[model samples]
Target: MNYFKKLLLILIVLGAKLPLIAQVKLPALVGDNMVLQQNSKVNLWGWASPNEKINIQLGWQTAPVVITANPDGTWKTAVDTPKGNEKAYDITIDASNKIILHNVLIGEVWICSGQSNMYFPVGKEEGTWKTGVVNYEEEIKNANFPNIRIFTVLTKASQKPLDDVTGSWKECSPASVKSFSAVGYFFGRNLYQKLNVPIGLIASSWGGTKAEAWTSEKVLEENTDFLPILENDAKNEKLYQEKLEAYYSDLKKERIANNNDLSKSQLKKPKKEDNKTSYVLYNAMLNPLVNYTMKGVIWYQGESNAEQAYLYRSLFPAMVKNWRNDWNQGDFPFYFVQIAPHKGQNPDIREAQLISSKSIANSGMVVTTDVGDANNIHPIDKQTVGYRLSLLARAKTYNEPNLVFSGPIYNNMKIKKNRAQLFFDYAESGLVKNGDVLKEFEIAGEDKVFYPADAKIEGKTVVVSSEKVKSPVAVRFAWKAIPEPNLFNKEKLPASPFRTDDW
Candidate 1:
């Protein structure tokens, strides 16, 4: 019972304290300053000591979910989120430590996906690549709406499927907006502004990925022509990994070999063995986030698949169906960005995108034909792109009547003795041709040769005829790649690109 006994007790206490203070394991995706999908039940998960009881208290003013840590030291529980309003909340666990999540909100959460266009976020001032940094700065700084949050899935490709991912959710503001998907941020921003609802966006995208990569293997298997992707994966167990390794090895070597730094070598390769093959990206990026809830998907891909535009007739629709089945959302409204006015594509892929939207159930397509810069695939002017997408959602998904969602979409065509009559879906003021007259229509006879048609709007229908062709068998509108297709609704929304005849 002396001073020596007291000193020994203190030493023992300090030894236990060191490890406890260091004991922190957070899921990479769940970290400080991250956005969580709102209005839906969210899963906040992490790991701790084996069999240790854990409690996650979330909300500025409510009850917290409590649970006992599992045998493996991992735990997860769902917390219901509130509508958009920035409010910081404290999460205390085990009466010892607490984590604070600031500026959280509950609202509509959308998965912004597809290829590089969707991932483009480099510029804000010029808009291309979100060049204007100040726009993002102002946006993130005043991100007071606790309702808007964003989560970005880091780009990764796997030869094999992965079950979980590492990322974090943070409230949307200027600081958060910088790293957010430029296209997605603009899209959600437009929707949030219009609807006054909380907005949550999950950015899961890869540059230069094919539509096939977004489709699930099982879903791809449903199509007779697309099943080969899965068969190949099964036959060559290591094909994906080995192929990716070789690709990266070559890519890295090239960067060093060229040393040009400005070589424009496409920088990277797809994450899977077959970058162009179907469902490779789905297995990794998408599959992991399927558990999150929300509205629909906004796609901005197809450049990599441009050469296969003809095949996309089936591939694109299959991708949509696969996602619908995966999400179990039963034909949840899907809207896509038609491939923009990129020069090399010659406008072929845009038509395919239009077809995918029109031919599918509960789907829509936004026309980027009028918005993109031909030289650069990454275009600015995203403000309108997002606004157009919102119009579609507001009209179709939310059933907001009296809302003009799109430009003219081909509704039906009737062939007269010498002319084809085209009926269109939208044109608030009745189809007024842009400028002098309606441009971008073509008529092809049985020989399958097509010539420009002199088309004019007459009482909501456009009658078309080409002096170069007689007895036309099919009518084509906006069929050419980057065709200066000018048809639009009174609302100024461009008509979706289209080609009537397969030939």
Candidate 2:
């Protein structure tokens, strides 16, 4: 090289080794056509040069908010948003560089997250239900809710919590809404209709993911019961590379024996990163959106943890509490859909979920016992699920008066001689047998051997008795994996399965 060119190469090599100074950069979430929580302090955050001053000018606000980036290049500020959606707004962030976000709306924002059931979209897709829902065509054809926006988090797994995620907000249109979570779309659509305001749904979910996968590492380590999950993850981290190499070696041998060309796409995909590993999904997907202000969260997970239903009693609630703490939102509405009835599932998982809902503050559970298909775990009737969830939000969260949002919930059981009388909440309007006379009730004596019981709905309580058990000590209703119980409230909502005995 010439003298001047060699000097330039030397300078370039030194520059490559030096740290590149970062300019003002916002997360993909804080982009155009986004919706901020209305009537609340919404968190807006991004990265800038260390100790750089950031001035945020919102079109709605008269005065610009000033903040300073920390030594680590992270900056955050809360902006107050008004309730009405009279006009679109813009946000300009000036730091080392300038970034302007346009067409922002202020409204109710919610996070919809869970497993496969929550990840299922409105449109017909591969590897899910064979066909779309019964009304999928009509629903998608008429879906033109511009006021409702949705942002779906891209699936990722990480060993450590990430500071940002990859996603973008889009207006709910026919094309956009088809691939979005069906439950989330219906929930947002219902909210917009009832409140007459803009609605934003942030969906962060993964198929076949356990609750522990969405929990913080610290939270899992603190509990001794979750030690197994941590230990398994440690083992997975250690052996992942070895397993991947072995898988590729076996695939190569098999292809050679078959005299087939080794196509790159045909090669067996290595499981380098597992979505089921504990705390990875939360680190990559959820951690990045910790303080994005929202009204509440809706969850539809539990099937993955059903095998360890007993442990989930504590773990599920801990995960919720951890999320609430991380979001800095004080017990905002955490509504979840109860798992539908399916064969081969541990019934205890449903019981555990119900307990968690009651234990957690400002939480509601939507019973889906009636709408489930016994054969398919992923039920296609997500419209009912979303509508039911909306009812809970409207009645409990939004203060809608006289709304019947719940079915019969166990209150207290009264034992009179050999018969057990069941008292339930949400039966003020009286109970109604949906179809065949209230089946699936069982009565047991001190021996704890339960027998099929004949139940009679007397007023608001159901009196259950079995001739075989003269001294009934306990009673259970719809307490099986594939129960088809015919019990409901006057409002036509199905009753949640319950067991009076702890066993």
Candidate 3:
């Protein structure tokens, strides 16, 4: 009996020791078909047993990097990447165990994120609501770019920041591209075609989510304008249980009324889901991607924040600053699409986006005034949106100085004797009205009442005049909530909406 006890004790000790030798793990991004940012030192991190020595070997480089896990079982190392090419690479890591990442590429890795428009897929397989883009069948059939890779973050929301997300790199093909974000796919395709380099797209977008959901909590806390959001969220949390109980009671009453054929109108609305809570998605979707190196980011959200458009001017820039700070990259390129001309969107939100684009360094905004559909919030012309974004990338990020990527933007206005002369910027090759007649221009006098103004292109400046207004103090162009833009640059890019009056 003593001998049996000794054997059992020895087995128990061995079992306890087995778990101490933890198997080395990697983040979801550092896997098969992944693309590392080219010509940069990209961060590669993972977890292992405390004090364990981790060895990393890159197929493209000769020197192997060695690191030690911290007390918390986390380790990080940066590896140098070569310029973008078609060659496939490998990464081998060994610690308590071995992990080999296959088919890695060196190229421009971009993060495509925002709301429903950015989440819309290239084909119909994503869900019942995501009914692919226009000519999606042809687009899918032609999506065979072997050099382009895609990684989509799984839809998940959390109140606290997560270390890693759930995703895997996929090579671009008909089968794999079917469920990919249409805007992301088209953007990558255009980049590959223009630069002739491999493109890796990381898509982390949720439909109908607000911009604050993707912004860091710290950012929202620092800004005074966003304090209301936090305060309201806290109050809402406190009331949530009571609200839920009331919802159930109301639901029960509605059920009884329905059974009696009386009415269902008394049913109460349930509290908003946790996913819509501020900073939830950032904690889940964006926090895990903070360290991943990327060339730039493309955003396509703002409709959800239209009600708070006035606040977005401050909040949006703060969010961009927060992202740049977390990435430790100095003002990396950030291009965004202006909210299209849908009935639900207001001019305030569009103006806020324009303000962000103008204020944020190394950033650009694509205007979708002409392409937006009034009936459908998710416009089917995603191709034009992607194409315009690529133009900005090609011009700004890729060092193509000769490319005219932007349409005419209002530079300054001169009011002289009842006529307003609007000087424009980016009127490359001169400005030309889209239709036979110029429209959507309004001029206001000192009384602040606006009247239809006759606008005509005179060189790079547009002259606006009204028969009634004797002294035009302000001028506006395409300032309505939904406008069919009629002005375009020689490149056919539509001019962004503008108003001279702050009120």
Please identify which of the two predictions, 1 or 2, would achieve the higher lDDT against the true structure.
2
**Which pairs clash in model 2?**
none
Predicted candidate 1 versus true structure: per-residue lDDT over 1-503, tens digit per residue:
79999999999999888754324355555555445555556677666766666666676446667786677767777667765554544555552345554554555668899887788762353433536423555555665544567788887766566666757787666666766777787778777777777677888988778887888767677678776556655666567667778888888787788894636786566554445555668887887676555678887888988887877888989888778877665787788888777677855677777777778999888887778777777776666777788888888877888988888888888888889998888865677666988888889899998888999888878899988777988888776555677777777887776667766
Name the weakest run of 10 consecutive residues (lDDT summed) in model 2: 264-273
Ranking by TM-score: 3, 2, 1
Candidate 3 C-alpha lDDT tens digits along 1-503? 69999999999999988856778999998899998999999999989999899999999989899999998898888888888899998899988799999999899999999998998899886355456889999999999998999999998999899999999999999999988889999999999998988999999999899888888888888778899989878898879978888888877777786885635375557757776788999999999998899999999999999999989998888888888999888999999999999887789999999889999999999999998889899888889999999999999999886898888888899988979999878995888887888989999999999998999999888999999999899998888788876998888988889998897
Clash counts for the predictions, in order: 35, 0, 0
Estimate the overall C-alpha local distance difference test score of candidate 3.
0.90
lDDT per residue for candidate 2 within 1-503, as digits (tens), equals: 89999999999999999977789998978999899999988899988888889999999979999999999998888888888583789899987789999889988999999998998898898776556655998999989988898999999999899988889999999899888999999888998999988898999999999999999999999889899888877897778878788888888787787776565435665565578988888899999998799999999999988898999999999999999999888988999988999996867999998898899999999999989999999889999999999999999999999999999998899999988999999999999997667799999999999999999999999999988999998999888999998898999888889898997
Best by TM-score: 3
lDDT of 2 at 113: 98
TM-score per candidate, chains pooled: 0.78, 0.93, 0.94
Which scores greater on TM-score, model 1 or model 3? 3
